[model samples]
Target: MTDILVSEIMNRLNSLFPSVSSELNSINDYTFLIAVLLSAQTKDKRVNIVTKELFKVASTPVQMLELGLDKLKEYIKTIGLYNNKANNIINLSKILIEQYNAEVPLDRDQLELLPGIGRKSANVILNKICNAPYIAVDTHVARVSKRLEFTKNTKVNKIEEDLYKVIPSEYHTIASNLLVMHGRYTCTAKNPKCSKCILKDICNSRNKYF
Candidate 1:
């Protein structure tokens, strides 16, 4: 799609989904990071349920260590990949305490250094926590981007680059969340609600005209 088309799509998306929200809205930075980590391969709703109890017991790095690995696993065991998630959470807590003085680093690279944190996770933290203008490309965003012809590249980093190049800076954060919410609800994977979709005309997906 042309830059003008991409810009129009973002504008329409921002208008439809006005609020900036995340399923993992932790009270503090420490809990927020843990929530995001636990969210991998799991639904946000599920992650929120687990974190509500998990954070009540341990919201800080030191408290997490005190919670212990085995006990931590017990709390988040219902989540997918709980075993690996538990291990990473514990180790990452230690790293935060020992390296960053138990604070969530704002730098993308620094945040990515933590266990279970990758480019997507780091971008989320930077955008939500640091208020950086970054559009984190998750499964929903990636799928929506491809459908909208934002980029043909399946690689997430390249997709992000393509989005940034076309989308206005003012709509960076809004655009990401908009596409995510759209993909989550209207433009779903298996069966999209194209009839009710505002971007139906602009969408280049195979099912757009269906």
Candidate 2:
């Protein structure tokens, strides 16, 4: 049952979203990480809007360090938690420069050790930046997993474990992006687009129909 469901979900999401790249392509690696960090409690659309200007000013660790805390805050003032996030960005930039030679570490452990990055953010970097097999379970991914009965747990780490238990490693990236996108657009929190959902037939969600 898990195998069949996973296969179907992958097909449907892949058909709708052929690729999940190009989201942070415009920015350098350091700026991309900053954008992802700033994305917490914020929308990607908003992040894009702010990053367009922020990246133009500081696209690297040294550049970001030179941008200063107040100026950094000003650039990302539109984002939620801008104050704290700006602090993390500055401190992390300093650490990256001092420790990692100003390069974003590819290792999850090293990356997580940096400020403004946790397990989920590290996982996202691992999957997207390093092309590693990691599925970062955000709120949308967790909701979709529960609704589909793909994961019985509500905790992000537990849900991620459940997904890894059943899902093949090769499909991790696609699966994560697909589930996140699906929950965002189709199987949303309110009034899910059941009629248009390809996985509706297989979905065990209680709120299937509008």
Best-matching candidate per TM-score: 1
lDDT of 1 by residue, 97-127 (tens): 9999999998999988899999999888888
Candidate 2 has a TM-score of 0.95
Instruction: Give the C-alpha miss distance for residue 9 in model 1, angstroms.
Output: 1.4
Q: What tens digits encode model 2's per-residue C-alpha lDDT throughout 1-210?
A: 568677777777788888765254345578778877988878888889998988888899999889899999999898899999999999999999999899889998898898889998888777787778888888888888888778788788899999997776668876777788888898888888888888877776744455
- List where candidate 1 sits over 4 angstroms from the true fold: 206-209
Q: Number of backbone collisions per candidate, in order? A: 0, 0
Model 2 off-target regions past 4 Å?
22-26, 206-208
Clashing pairs in 1: none
Task: Assess candidate 1 and give its lDDT.
Answer: 0.87
Model 2: lDDT equals 0.83
List TM-score per model, in order: 0.95, 0.95
